[model samples]
Target chain A: MLKSNPGLALCILIAIGAICFALFSGDPYYVQVVIWVFANAALAVTLRFVLLIGELNIATAAFFGIGAYTTAVASTILGWPFFISLLAAPVIAGVISSLFGWITLRTKGPYFLLISFAFTEIVRLIYTKTEALGGNSGMIGMFPPMELDAYFPAIAISILAAILFGLYAAERSNLGRVFKAIKNNEDIPRSVGLNVIGLKILCLVIASTAVGLVGGVHAYTNSVIAPADFTYFVAVLALAYVKIGGEGHIVGPIIGATILTLAGQFLHSFGPYENIFYGAIIIGALLLVPGGIVGLGVRFKAGTLMGRAGR
Target chain B: MELQVQLLMNTLQIGSVYVLFALGLTLIFGVMKIVNFAHGTFFTAAALVVTSVMMWSVDTIGMPIWFSYLIAFVMALLVVCVIGFVVYFFGFKYVLKDLNGSFILSIGLLLLLNGTYLILYGGVPRSIPAVIPGNITILGASLTIQRLVLMIVAAIITLGLYILVHRTKLGLSLRAVAEDQEAAMLQGIPYRRVALYGFLIGATLAACAGALMATVTPVTTVIGDDFLVKAFIIIIIGGLGSVLGAILGGLLIALIESFGGYYFDPSTATLAMFVLVVILLIVRPQGILGHAEK
Candidate 1:
């Protein structure tokens, strides 16, 4: 079934390995890493969804926060079931980002970036200060639908797998082409009589919703949610995933996030020095592999990469 | 009434350092077309330099206060300029034409610089003693003499920068480069020299602000985070590439932050600024002094 695409095959094998590891692997640490990889993979793809339309969104944490918080509130405050809250999280996030997109997407580039930056801080402060949202105490005692230790991670990967498949389908569709057109030249899309704003909002909404769903998965996996979890640094780190993975390809973000997440595992003991390593990874990717790891793969295929065997 | 006067002084005291940063940030953007995320780190790093210099001079070398300050200021300027040039060479040169690449590169630079700073300085907030230890009371409001001196120094630098950008031959070349890189390059202006000088001068101004700030505020590795965000808002509201807009934007932010913080909570102050920037985006995307549409 996966013979036609090697990339799809790799994803399948990885998903299988993840499930097997979660089910049978003795080490909880590696299982957690697998789950973290999946969570970031979903985020990286969501970010790529927006980037596909040429928008430099630094607001991943904001929408993610919205998703996580909404789920927490729905589950705890409103006494909704985990399943319903999980579904509602992305919807709430999508609606919120729609409002944001309506206002801020009017501006482009750095202005868009700044507005997104502001949104994260604003959301964080509101959550931090608002008593209704538990203020600084945040929401705790989240029970996943399943009680098993591995259940949340399994569900998280399943959610991510679904998103990956959905994104894969979208990448081949006409809608993706419109996003690319907008990315390449907004004026061209406008000249073709496409509603540029509408298309952008579409991409933003889709990306926001997907990211929100991941945020829901995140809250359940950790069994607690806090405003601190979705800070600007986390958002920037998400952006770095897509950047270090590669641009202009679907698999780049997955590769980037997986590599970086695993690297984080090793660098965990580095403590304060971990950030320096992250910075070094990003800089190295930009300088040496502007195409990211996938780009390097593409180059090797094209026989342009030094000391690498070409197909 | 006393509160108002103190707030006014407070506005200028913070606004002066903010203006120094915003002006340098805008000038660098004008020349390089890349927003330096590490710009605030530059400010903090330079402040650290100034703080260390003063401590060494006053305690270790036992120099007179004025002489120590003089040495600190000059050395900080030289050191920061070199740092700026090195960043330009290593961090920025390859990605000069690629806006996104350069922006990400600078983001990496921010993390790298801030991390190095944290490890080196150990997260302890430090402050140099006031350049002059006297408080002047005006209208029943007491204000530190250091802040007053800082305002004057800020004025001198602003005036000097205004002269440098508007009057001198080098200024002409720099502005020409900003106007049109290719045309200026074709017109016999050395691109690297103009860019390097503009960047160095901007970095030096930040160094001056950092040094001056050492006398007023505690210096920490993470202190730059707030200023960097403020600089972005200032330049955006002031419009990118306009020094006057940076000045205006700086004052507007300082006022907003001060008045808003007083009237509301810290979150409200920041929240208000965020709202204003959003509204400005809809109404006047070019900013008050920026050219139409970035």
Candidate 2:
């Protein structure tokens, strides 16, 4: 029943549409936007993976920054190829995440969150203040991929969609069942003799690697890597995207990124009003639709349509 | 010796401001699990209120400096408290019912309040005219009377808060609610009312700090972001809910920034403080004052 679901059909349609939109837009400016949306979506999905285990790591931005800078510095200074730098980016980020998780995994809830945030701030501060790197003036003149001639946006979106679906499928598989069990009752997962710490750390590494990939692409696409781009606000925005779109499923990040990007474009001229709009949407969603749009759809079907059909 | 004295004074002044701000944040966090991202927005709002009032008094009405400061403080406090109450009722009610639910909602409120400030006030740093005219030398250290006044006011407020929390009936109720909300609700404490009071008190504290800070530093819409980070840092360092711990944490951060900046690069100093927070968490996650359960 699960293998032959209508949701899978919907997912495929959405993926195709997204890929088509990216390819056809043909605007250079829109290409940059696509890169940003995919990068953030990847990070949001990573956030979702951890959130499933009831944890919020506020350092996703820091890791993203780390990956971006690592790639930027390697390409700019060492004259490495884009693909090689991209490959190294996640390894660097994953190493940092592993060290951070080693220290912070024992602390629970808000304290854990605060410490992670501090870690992010430290990375940003180091990036900004180190004159040897760039100081407050920021890193400039990054190089983009040489191989890709056209349809970069489509490529990026397709890659991101592929990653999202990959993660979603993994979550639905037998391995995914372990993640659900861990989320349901952490102690029960432990009592069942599951390797909880190993599983969580593995998730963190995987998420960091995903973010690192996006960061590398972004660094190359933007031709710049500044400390300002990777602040606590970035992390919060990623979390917000996940929360507003829906935490329980992978499509939520896509929906969230799409909605926010569109909303941002429309309200771009309004300055802070855009944020107020974003915030209001978040608050309304949390209050009225805790399960998010997907959850709302489920409730509608179960409460009205399904009940009526039964009658 | 003179340089040492100057650094000490600067550290003390900045430390006091942070202590006041972080203490306010801790109070709310203690009672409500909500992070109150809007906590620092109140600081900015209060600063704006202080700035506008002081501007009107001096620039428009030509009032005395002393009177201007007093009026600014009161008006700012009143305005922020009202905002706090409104936030508690409108934004917080839903979030507080479910921890995860409110976190997202509060985040939205953070963006909204920040945007509101940006829209109302242009994104520029505006300073409050100093009330005291000149500096006075004390114990071989020259200090501005305005800085001294700020320190004194901060101390008095902190002490007043300490007494209020430990000695009063309302403070006791606040504590009860913080300890266990449902149990406190069972005692006919009216949890929502107490939560509102907590919000008001926290808002008032943060506002007062903002007003006081305006005298020392210029006010900008984005300044709240800096204060929010500092407050979150302090709350973590001092532990979540402990009053005494917040005071120590504030001072500790202040001293770290002061000495670290003096010894190393300013950026490195900031990074060090954050690194220390991570180290401290691994060593003792509960912080200087927080209990194990928290």
Candidate 3:
């Protein structure tokens, strides 16, 4: 069925899953877990947008933090409406992404990775060191600025769906094709008079904006924010979602986020040992199935599952 | 003038330890082209190893502090050497041919190592007793003997590394493999062994650094993250894949951070170093001494 009409099948499957999740959203724990998954999915998908362009950004969490803090400060400090504050999240993220992207995206590989990685540190440091930002204690007592609670899962689902669909739309658009072309060979387009840097910055804006929006939602959902929440671990974990879910398609983040988020719950009882479990799974996944669970499914579909699991 | 001397001493002490850590990283990266994200974990693990060994010997066996430190130092090296060997075999061997693959796998190694450390040690903080206590006042500035020794140790190691890389068979094999892996293989250079040797030596050096730093500061699992980032900035500004580059880079960063912290907020000291790296990359992404990619 997947091969027969992959797009149609995916749409139908998600519709059914979203409906079931929405029905169960009445439970606070269920809704919270679902929100966590959505927030992470948004982040992983945003990360995917750049990963599509063959750039690895480990700073999506920083942008996510930007959105969260912006929302927190706007709502609590300035008495802004949730809608207005939320809008500022992505706008702020886009502006920063463009500025930083222009400067850092000039380099690639480790250079690109390091600069992007530093972004999280800078943001975290600013938030931690600046007393106005609440420093290490962070800000709390947040609620969704609008009647988002009445809609609950509808709002959450819509946000997650919008990011996924936005990504889906991009995959089908000329921009996506250009992204692919750029990713495959930046020089090929450079010879053809394309503005490579502009496109790359565009990629950053879109990805950071999506992640930033989720950050606002994340703050709204949690009602508390801390610098510790947006660390190097979160960024790396988002990359894991993309890698293990399947980077080639939009479904990868969905699958990867769902499994890992659920797995996190399963291991919660283990306390500190939970990280050990997560680490082991990621290491095993990288060594044994670097292509991720989706790739494994694809391999199984074609009957080449044997002798190729260790790639 | 007193403050200036003290700050310079502080810079040298920190910079020396950083050189120890950064050189190991540059060595592995130079030969393998794999960024070991978990490079910091080795430092932490070695500290843990040294701390536990020293505590056990001093508390249980009633050994002297100096003798216990000696035992801890050798044991830490052995433990970290094993960790490096395991890392190379489990992480590097599989992704040897793929740069992107190694990068992703290294993150996994990092998470795995971090999680493992958390499980074993919990979040408790411990400190390694100073192996060489007491201070030597030099020109109206008092500095710990341990720190001054570390500076000299760093200088000696730098000279030793230069000699080893230039004058030894193992270094010849490593240089040959690094220069041209395919060509080296054709010439029957056991590049895999060279990689293993490099990783072990690098790990041993990192252990030395961890042991040294732990004496002066507290040993916490997360301490590695800060040092690792500094090492990264050092290699980035100094240029990756060169020993001399790491030394020079380490000192430059240490000085910037020391001065920056003294003049500004101490918490933003790393921010200063990070900003310097960004500006450096914008002007010269290949780093100060790194060869430009063809």
Candidate 4:
């Protein structure tokens, strides 16, 4: 089933569902959460770009933080409009991602992981240390959408869904196949005379922008921004969702994000148990269900139980 | 001159502590080829163990200050090793063959441990018993005896680790496992036993570092985050799967942090270490002591 490449059909379904939900849901909180899911999905799928290329770039949170902080600073400190900050957020994240790619992508394996992880820490530290970004306490008083019209939720979610759909489409295209090749066999890609580094940088930039846009929406929704929301925890959640849902498929992150977000929010009363549960889920998924929930379905249909068990 | 000496000592002390932290991380990577993010959680658990010992005062044994530390280290090591063993057996064992799968599993373990720490210890930072009596002034430079002892202990541990790696049969097996697990198994080396030993050693070193660091920085749920970051930097700058690289990386980062903290802002100093590491990684992707092995 996964071999058929159902990405386009999945995106259309998601788009229709998002619009319908916005149109019918009376509760603003519910609508807001949908927006949040979209934002997270976009970020997660974009993050898949690097992962698809076999790079464990764990700095999505950093780029997201940059976008969120940029929006906050641009809106409050510079008194820019929400729209302006939204546009600038991705640019800021993209620039930072470019610099990061230049310094990082040169290494392989755990070294590369460390480089990206350290980069996130630096971003977080800077976010916490700088008074301009609101220091350890984080920033507040972010500008909300200028027009809180009834269509805001629908429009925002639509735009997010569209951008995410674009990303999903791009990944399925010829360009994405090249990335998959690079991930599977780095030397093969290089041997074929592909500019591997350039492709990585391009993907990083594009993915960074997608994540940044989500961060921008995050800021506007809350009308406040802080370091805590854009943290390693968020990064973990995004990555976990991608892995648990199925990293190889676009719908995987979407499904993963929705389940985790809703579960995390509703079952939050269990306190830290949620984290433990989340951890267990990821580990279990990796160990017993490497193909994720979707992969399991595919395996079951084919009657390949053992194949399903292994990645 | 005195201040400079004091700074040098401080740098060495911090660097040594970092070395201790990175030692376990490097070992696990070296032997099992597993990047254990849960490594930091072991340190956190150790810090908590130290705190619990100070607060509860397990009176059945009744030992001296140094003996209590030894007991604390031992107790923490046992707890973390058991945890590590279970995680490795359940989550990591099967996933070990796949680097990506293992990476995700370790991260999950990290989250579980962090959550566990928060649940068991609370988010509040707890203090450990400061057993060292006083400070010693040498050539007009003042230093806490505990700090001095911790530094010595770190050096001793480093030397011991070096000896264990280079001088022992277990060390040879470890090197063998790291170089090629399949080949090592073909040579009749007990791969699992070596890996268990590696996990035990990693857990012990991490706990030891945590116990020592708790004396200086106290114990908190978030301590793992800071130490994890530092360890990552050390492992990267020093070189992945390289024991000596971890040592050198730890010291280099420590000196940079020490001097940077004084000369520049604390935040900038931290940033400097990462920036320098990133530059170094870009220049030599294999790290200072790391040789790319196929």
TM-score of chain A of each: 0.93, 0.89, 0.93, 0.92
The C-alpha local distance difference test score for the whole of candidate 1 amounts to 0.83
- Model 1 spans with C-alpha error above 4 angstroms: A1-3, A146-150, A307-311
lDDT accuracy of residue A126 in candidate 4: 81
- The candidate that wins on lDDT is 1
lDDT string, candidate 4, B1-294, tens digits:
888888899888998889988989899888878788888888888888887875655355566766787777777777777877787777766765466677788888887888888988797878766678799997788999989888998889989999999999999999999888999999999988898888789878988888888777778886866788888888988888899999999989888888889988788888998778867876788889988745
Best by TM-score: 1
* Shift of residue A100 alpha carbon in model 2, Å: 0.8
- Per-model lDDT: 0.83, 0.79, 0.81, 0.81
Candidate 4 segments whose C-alpha is farther than 4 A from its true place: A1-7, A306-311, B58-64
Q: State residue A176's C-alpha deviation in candidate 3, in Å.
A: 1.7
Interface RMSD of each: 1.4, 1.6, 1.7, 1.4
The DockQ leader among the candidates is 4
Error of 1 at A304 (Å): 1.6
- Please, what are the lDDT tens digits per residue for candidate 4 over residues A231-299? 666777788888888876778888888888887778778888988898888887777767777776677
What TM-score does model 3 achieve against the real structure? Answer: 0.95
lDDT of 1 at B123: 81
Query: Residue-wise lDDT of candidate 1 within A1-311, one digit each (tens)?
Result: 57888878887888877877787778878888888998898888887788888777778788888888888888778889878988888999999989899888887776677668767877898899998888887889777765654566676787878887788778679999999989888998899899999889988998899889888888777778888888887777877888888876877888888888988888989866988888877787787678788788888888878874422
Ranking of all candidate structures by their DockQ, best first: 4, 2, 1, 3
Model 3 over residues A1-311: C-alpha lDDT tens digits? 46887876777577558747776556777767877787777788888888878888888888989988988898889888878887888888888888888888888777677767777777898899988889999999778745566665557667767777787788769998888899898998889899998999898888898888888878877889999998877878887888788877877877898889988888889866776677777778777777788887888889998856334
Chain B only, TM-score of each candidate: 0.96, 0.96, 0.95, 0.94
Model 3 residue B270 distance off true place after TM-score fit, in angstroms: 1.8
Cα shift from native, residue B273, model 2 (Å): 1.2
lDDT at B131 for candidate 2? Answer: 90
What's the ranking of the predictions by lDDT, best on top? 1, 3, 4, 2
lDDT of 2 by residue, B87-125 (tens): 877778666635456557667877888888888888888
